[model samples]
Target chain A: MALEAEVWSDIKPIPLDDGPDPLAPIAYDAEYSEAMGYFRAISQRDERSERALKLTERIVEYNPAHYTIWHYRQQILFSLNKNLNEELDFVKEQIESNPKNYQLWHHRQVLVEKLMDASCELPFINEILNDDAKNYHAWTYRQWIIRTFNLWENELDFVNKLLDKDVRNNSAWNQRYFTLFFNPTKPTEEFLTQEIEYVIEKIKMAPNNISPWNYIKGIIAKSNKDIGILEELCKEIEKQDIISPHAIGCLVDIYESRARKGSATDKEEGIRICTLLAEKHDAIRKKYWEYRKVILTSL
Target chain B: MPTEKEFVRDKHISYLKRGLTLLPKQYASNDTNRMTLAFFCLSGLDLLGALESEIPEERRKTWIDWIYAQQILPDERNPEINEKICGFRGSPFSGLPFDPNGSRESRLPFDAANLAMTYTALTSLLILGDDLSRVNRSSIINSLKYLQKDDGSFTQTYQGMESDMRFLYCAVVISYILNDFSGINIEKAIDYIKNSQSYDFGIGQGPGEESHGGSTYCAISSLYMLNKLDEGLLSKEKTLFWLISRQESGFQGRANKPPDTCYSFWIGASLKILDKLELINYEQNHNFLMQTQAKFGGFAKLIDNYPDVMHTYLGIAGLSLMNEPRFLELDPAINISKKAKENLLNNCAFHKQK
Candidate 1:
């Protein structure tokens, strides 16, 4: 790309700019200088440039809080013909400096995908997932990576590990459903039972969460292989709800859907449920409208 | 006894007051994301005729100063790149300099010409009842011209980002509010909005994208501002039909999406704009919104969730549109403080030069 003209006048780098300190500089507010240096370097490079990378390293080393600089650095590195390993190391350095930056964490996942494409074996993804099991980006990206690599066979174990770490991750719950429903290679019924039981336990512990309820709803909707198990799950929903009003409508929708599919509830039963719901919750009058339709249609 | 209108006024006042109270005292400097919310809360109050007893002028002035300071200047050319006309940074990121004009700032080029911010800033100033005399309209016009992409859709800024009807609407609002259209390539932009309308009669984020309630509002509202509402671009029957269809008790922004409280204003306002709001059962819609009200006196995206300022204000605004007996009258044009808009119109007429 043809470069735009330089509009800025050069000013002295400030009194604190005691030339580049070679030793791990105790402290340096080199944000402005480093940022300018990176911009200047990128402006000149016809192809991918390493000069911007070097400046980024210096910038991050001196001022770790400069997150935008890191983002800029990532862009520069990604654009450059840098190897995947180099990109990974650069991101690792950034994450180590500022682990709380969700954008960087997301970028790390992007880097991993690129690395995987390059056929580079890396355990960094597992390490990050293990560190923060609830990290939505990490879980989502891992799933993407697994799906791309056609590694659904090992996904059961991967999910087990994730749940072992954090049982309450909604992203994990979603992942489990995705794997169970969409995975070409399904796990054994016993393994599925255990996972569902664990999910049930988690739900019992925290009934307010919509994810577990949604997960249960998804599980019941897909497979009618075990009617007894489905009955038990329905019983659990009725008895165990912590009374989160938001979850009530979602739960009702699931039940209504099940009723429509002829999962046990007859047309009369569905109408009774809708009538009861209409009387009980004024909030979901719109939702009951659907149940009313289902009852009318069934009749 | 308060009249129904007075009750609505009280509700609006209480809602806006709660929104203001929820604002964190100190946000990150670059965090201009809340500027619109701040403008709406303050301006919304002013419009509701409830601002004076609530937010004082001295505090409002301070907010005005802080918002204006966020405007990136055109004169301070980046030492490395001069052609880059300085624009408002949404929020000062970690590496960006505190100085309004500083070199080596890690600026999101996407904010290079934020039509939304420009509109908000202008609207905010107008809402605060500031004279248009001091605003640098020429610089804004110049920056705005650059944000328009060749495809007719406006990039949020000069840097390549999401281009859609939203920004196009923003550009129109900014230009129109400033009383200047020189900044925008109007023909191309109108074409973009036209192309963005889905077969469903709702506006999507862009062409081939899913239609959303918010984007639909933007598209329709922009057309309304541009004096193109009745044009062949949007058929009244189809537009009204699509807008009315959004109501399932309350309104959802799109197909298969759960109703959010903000959509009550967004899609509701769109229906009103189309003069088809009567298609919705107003009592049902009002009841649905009332259910989403948090026990603590603010509205959430839905009931049983924590209340937020945006949803709270929007819910009230939605109710206001329904002619709910208790809220203040709204001026949708600038979405300005209706009171401020009135004040401005009165002042303009009072000082008529002719």
Candidate 2:
């Protein structure tokens, strides 16, 4: 992928120096080394020409994780006043190949910010999420786009769709919270109650799923509501013979909070749940449950 | 039924030695991060107690020289222009000429230092038993000021890289090793770390990001190095509970995520740093790590997954934290052998003053 020999004839490529003794030297492909050598020379000269842009594209194709090359490519795109729409298209292709690359996401952000248009971001990120629901970079970038462009109106619906598809999608649950609470208006008491109800329904669908449980806890904490609200629901679930570890874990937290607030009855309840978790339900974290029991007993 | 496996000490040593000599073609994309790769091998060997017996003294000296060569020393002519760019590049990928003696006249335009690379390079030098007399401490400290964003998070470099909890950890580690806090705005940084605490009570890469074991380690370790672990966390008990809950036979980066071998160190080391290492179910954790141990030489991310250098190092470090007698003791906060940390304390000039 090195530049045509005659195109950069005037420049001498700068070879990489690995000092006297290089450790763990990667046997790079010949194409990569040649392109990098010329790239080093072009970058040294601070070139912002079309040739430099082409060189960057070649290097980026080889390694999309190169932040320096992406930075330089952005500068070239700006200095040359190249068609940014075309650049966006190029970035879209790169992102499709390297969905987890932070550099590609950052490059896309720079391009979108400069274009002053976030219209294409949501659908594009949705497509990426459809492939891998928990792509962290895609979710974070989607959040940034939403916050920056005031695209919060449909975010909850998008999160709902994702949750309907996969109830265990923690990223989607986090987004639901972000869309509701991180927006401009503060969440009202009615809205908090509705969110708690929504999470409780999701929890009933899958009692062991921790995402909804965490979501309900977050909603309660945000409203400064008491954890006691979930006590009756836990008891009802247990009455139905559903022995969910997450439900029990939540009960332990609820009781632990009340116990710490000087409720002796809640302390005993917390110790009982901790024992149940240690002996029967969740033996994997037996030590953690035992530790919880010790704290409760001490209280 | 699965049979428990013994720690493959010899195989791991061979795996690390192979990485130190020549990496496979798949690592070509990691050419820019050669320093980090080298750190994984050298530090892994150090933890395995093979540094003295496996690598000769002369070879170690050469490595020390090579790491010193990566240092981005300030341009004496225009110190102000080069001030914020002083630290270590990951490699000579920027095409700087070989200058093991560091007598270069001018700094190149693209030869900027990265915070992660600087942290790894400094630790590598220490692991190789160098005195670090040649490190440009002031320049690096000055660069940290530039790297820190207004939000108190740090970018990897001054050239506008992605800022996150990982880079924040690197910045803190660099300052901790240099024995200077002037470069960091402690209050703002602590605020940033505090804000990164997710509702699950685990720390994330940034505010509103999902709680992850790796970022949790970085965030907690940064707070520990800053002398604010107890005060900095939103809720110590909840955070510890979240961390302990990650151990579903083995550790997962996040809830509902499949168990990965590396989180054994990420979460396990975080627990160790919090002085709650004993809380982990050691036998279960050991059994999980045994499942991930590759038959050849390294540990994989999951059972039957391919072995790689990073996981190999972390898996062994996780065992070391559990007080596994076969491996050297690790300083969980720094992710290096306790012996190497002792070397830093006794010999490095920064500690000499203390």
TM-score of each: 0.55, 0.98
Considering just the first chain, candidate 2 attains a TM-score of: 0.97
lDDT of 1 at A260: 62
**Chain B only, TM-score of each candidate:** 0.83, 0.98
- Per residue, candidate 2 scores C-alpha lDDT tens digits across B131-182 of 8899988889988999999999999988897799999999999999888989
Model 1 fnat value: 0.00
Best by the DockQ measure: 2
> Residue B101, candidate 1: how far off, in angstroms?
13
Q: Which residues of candidate 1, in runs, are more than 4 Å off? A: A1-75, A78-299, B1-32, B76-87, B91-113, B232-234, B343-354
B257: Cα error in model 1, Å: 2.3
Query: Could you give the CAPRI-style class of model 1?
Result: incorrect
**Which residue ranges in model 2 land beyond 4 Å of their true spot?**
B103-106
Candidate 1: tens digits of C-alpha lDDT, residues A181-279? 556676677876676787678766665554565466446544454333544445556676445432444444445557666766544555555555556
Q: lDDT for every model?
A: 0.58, 0.88
